[model samples]
Target: MAIYSAERRRLMEMLHPGRHQVFSEVLSSLGAFMEKEILPLSPKLDAGEASIAKPRKALFEQGMTAIPFPVQYGGLGLPFSVYAMAVEMLGNADASVALSVEIHNAVAEGLLRYGSDGQRKKHLAAVISGKTLASFGLTEPASGSDSSTMATTAEKKGGEYVINGSKMFITNAGEASLYMVFAKTAKGPSCFLVEAPNPGLKFGKDLKKLGMRGSKTSEVIFDGCRVPEGSLVGQEGEGGEYAKEILHGARIVVAALNVGISQIAYDKSIAYAKSRKAFGKPISEFQLIREKIADMKTGIDAGRLMYLYAARIKEMGGDYTSEASQAKVYATEMSLKACDEAIQIHGGYGYTTDDLHRHWRDARLLTIGEGTSEVLRMLISRKELSRAQ
Candidate 1:
């Protein structure tokens, strides 16, 4: 069965029945492409036997990166929910690719929201169209999720801004052709569109990771990386705000991605339960096994609905920050639980198998990445309290 066949239909029916056929057609085609091209590469990607470049390029050619943007920038002009669903499918196929593509789209989003007309003309189209790949540079060694404490600095020199400091754990670090770099200026936090191959820009070796190894992660160092004044995105000192807004949307997508991971893990567990025999019958017949299966499916459904709810709010142009955080917190933790139950249901095989455990591994990152669950809880509470007041 297709990944988006059943639940996706329900989501589209609830959120956008009028466009259901269009979404089904486009996503079905994309899902077919993923099953053919990306799924086969997942094992190789996990084993370090294949580079992610070819499959990533293939996905880009299929216009996965341009799904939610406006038509003027070569996007499909689809609703954000469609894009969220697409990310879920990608996560089902391969988490690393989903992470890379998600971060890339976030950069496109940043440009759309904050870039000047010239910057948009120069970079946004290329990025969404996948003519150029971009990475976000905000997190630093000392600053994990807290952007206010970032130590990176940019100084005005004549007409150029000279940036200094490093970004840690940057996704697509070495491979990206452009970076949306954030740094402190005399005014405050700022954003710069730094293109690749600058004399002052350098990337550290790719870090060996416990999961999502298919995507590149490294330190991005800026030794006085210089860019023209025009490279600045939005107003100076507003990069922090831009980053927050960008991340709110990203949290929704991250939630979708985790739901995808949970779906895959749940599917695998169900198949395993039906096939693997215990006590002369399929283990799925056991009461405990059935309970785990029920919880896994329920959690996956709840996570999917939560993210889609956040996406709907975003589509309607409402304040979705708290909703986004709630989805991220719930879905990420829910995925971890589902994957763990999947591993438990598989028993010894799950503990030893890379394919089974990798789902858990990949799901593990999101809880810590976008916004840590603890932090998101606080943010959500603060929003609710302020709204009540």
Candidate 2:
């Protein structure tokens, strides 16, 4: 059975007629561009390490550089829905690259929303054009789910604020030109825009992980790193609020990425099942294989719908924290299952690295990164309880 019914497609199409058209064009363009310009470059770089560096320039030039931001800053300023669909397509092709771009967009959106005119002029253009990259520095070594426990401190000095703390598992940490770092100031936990190459800012060696190898993940060490007093982003004591809002929106993006991955895994598995034979016929002819394919397709479709719903809520400027968490948790878990089923359908070949094991490895990270499945469950439970009260 086809998971996406005509009614569902029509509803999705109706969400934003003009924007969807543009999104479709951009997705098609991105797919072609990745095949020719980006994926071909993947071989030259560490399939894992190259995620941060390899596609940064091309993605900016060909993808993000033209969307989301204002025309004044060399961007198309397209609707968020369009930008999100493009992200989903990119994610389907290469998640590491998609994630890197997503992080950049997240930071850029923060700057656009909270940055002063001077700050925007100084930084936004380069970021929009891809001349420079940025990362969000919120997760501390000790603070993963509980950001309130973050201990990174920023002390005031003469005409400057000195930051001393470390951010762990930061994407695009070493390679970024700017970092939006959160720290404890006298006022409270505040955000600071720290420029790169500062004497006091250091990056630990890249941490090896099980998946998402293409995206660079590292720890940032801040030892009395100083930036001007004007470097503060948004109002003092309001960093937490900003962080929450950013994260709420980010959850939707993460869900979209996972949905994309799930769809790709389903497609690959379906193709593989049709070709791989067992007994006297193709394995796909078996009832068990048919059941697996049906389940995988159903999961991917459900995940995609959840993501689109979340995206729509965001577009409507609704309070989407619960919906976003639901989407993230559901889609990521679905992708993990779908990926596993894909491997199971492949049987022995799936266990081997040469087969679709890489997709499985990549899917593993979806459940953990951004926000772990556990954290998301807690978030959803809290929201539900609050509403009941």
Largest TM-score belongs to which candidate? 1
Local accuracy of candidate 2 as per-residue lDDT tens digits, 236-288: 88898888878887888888787767776787788888998889899899999
lDDT of each: 0.93, 0.78
lDDT of 2 at 300: 74
Residue-level lDDT tens digits of model 1 in 1-389: 68666778777878886878887788888999999999888878987888998899889989898889999999999989899999999999999999999999999999999999999999999999888989999999999878899999999999999999999999999999999999999989999999999999999999998889799999999998998989999989999999999999999999999998999999999999999998999999999999999998888889899999999999999999999999999999999999999999999999999989999998999999978999999999999999999
> Whole-model lDDT for model 2 versus the true structure?
0.78
Clashes of each: 0, 2
Candidate that would win on lDDT: 1
Show pairs that collide, candidate 2: 48-213, 48-214
